[model samples]
Target: MPDMRVVLARELGYCSGIRRAIDAAETALRSEGTVAATDTLLHNAGEMNRLGSIGLRSVELLSDEELGAATVLLPAHGSTLSEHLGRIASARAVWDLTCPIVNRAHDAVSRFADAGVPIVVVGDKEHRETRYLMEAAGSQLLRVVTSEQDLDTLEISVSRVGVVYQTTQSREFRQLVLAWFRRRGIEVAEEMTLCPEVLRRQDGAVALARRCTAMLVLGDSSSANTRRLVAVAVSACPRTYLIGDAAVLPEVGLNCVDIVGVVSGTSCPQTTIDEVVAGLRQVCPDVRVEVDAWPESVL
Candidate 1:
């Protein structure tokens, strides 16, 4: 008889902001006949597909044709609110679903740009959230970096640097970047704009990894927070795998590990977590699963 134990992270699955965005999108789609988003409204493909089946359209960028034909839903990840709204200009019904925390991040970066301070963003340069932050900063002196190596390539001439990161970046990574800039004698304004829930998820991932023999992170490939969860888990538990769903569990050699921790990205659906746990049960029928509640203390 194989002895298998699975533990669920306390802070796994969808955060309030994502829930609100989805709820709002669903409500709007029902009333508006057709709704379009500036980008994928949520990173979870399952949730996106659900909305798609009901006629929720995703547009890479809004053009006159899109603005005129349907209600445009701005994503929870920050978008150029004023700019986008202005472009529409009373031509269409618009729902501003930008998360309040993300809006705050945008405002913080705008303030730094207004003060003429050189800006450095710690996140994936091509990420939608990072792109929003860059757009909010306008033409200010800006550099975006993910690691210490990326920082070395910056050609910044300013002595004073303003720092802000994507809402999904882990706090530990943010501190490391801040320390690196300070060591170089740069005056770094540390305006950490990370989502509290997302940061908590990373904390939870670290704790989950420390206790489990292996870890499974649930999230879509395009989810930033999901990728962060994977990174955090791998740092502590070398046997960490990022899977979009539970179907990959078998191929990833899960049966070899006696204990596994299950953590998910903020945007990941609760149903996916349930499905993964169910799949685990099916794989190891006699396995005992426990809910790891260590993350509750941090909350």
Candidate 2:
């Protein structure tokens, strides 16, 4: 019998921004006495659990008081200016791990809003990223929605519109949004704010799954990028499953399959992927584990 050939997408795992965020968090945890993160380090549960093992804790950006010798780390997702102002008033020092791309999108909100463009952000309203964008735009009201109907439901009276997306949103979603405006006879002036990491990861996942009989994704269920990876692979490869860890790998007639592709999301730690690979190797000892030859990066 041929052992399964296992593969991984080129652009799987943590991106550069997440790497920086985790690094800053670990540094804060190791610092003497006490340090505070304006909020959770990242959205990944695995990463958050790892941080919890250390001395760090998640503090609301709204939580402010006198801090004697503590370092306050602004969220990598970037808090609103108002939140930063509140934190700046008392923290000894601040470390900002905000991703450069995310920063640009934030800056655009105000720039476009001031130019009389109605701002419509495509992301979850409750998310910290979207919240910060709303704050930066300084609008008494803003609209946040996910689907086409959500866009049509908006009562925005402006003729011109400024559009931006959640950091990890799919390009297809954005395209659909763009097309919607065209059909409605409204023009959108969008910022160049697509998430490079998500685009890269989606491309990689699609490419890698094209050849594999089955695909497996490792990530937290709540992670948008993680779920997006799964969706990307599944669209190309019919057999795809998103697993939180290695122990969840389905062994249903594994002896019948010739190959499987494995991948992880930006929020996933490399260590978790290694563990999954190791576990699967134990299950299918002869499985050929490989990575793409094209290219893969931290994104």
lDDT, each prediction = 0.82, 0.76
Candidate 1 lDDT for residue 270: 82
**For residues 1-299, what per-residue lDDT tens digits would candidate 1 score against the true structure?**
77689988777777888989989988988884557886788898888998889988765455677667778788888676564756655436878888888888888999999988778878888887888898877877478888768867766667888898888888878878877777788888878798888878788888889988888999998898898889888999999999788788788787834698888887888888988888888778777878887844243
Cα TM-score per model: 0.91, 0.89
Model 1 spans > 4 angstroms off = 59-69, 81-91, 295-299
* TM-score winner: 1
Candidate 2 off by > 4 Å: 60-66, 140-142, 250-256, 294-299
Q: Return the TM-score for candidate 1, rounded to 2 decimals.
A: 0.91
Residue pairs whose backbone atoms clash in candidate 2: none
Task: Rate residue 14 of model 1 by lDDT.
Answer: 79
lDDT of 2 by residue, 1-299 (tens): 56777877776678888888888788778778566676776767777877777866555533455353567777777777776677465777778888877888888887877876778888777777888778766663357767667877766656678888878888778888888778777878888687887787787788878877878888888777788888878998888888788777655334435577887877788888888888777677687777777465343
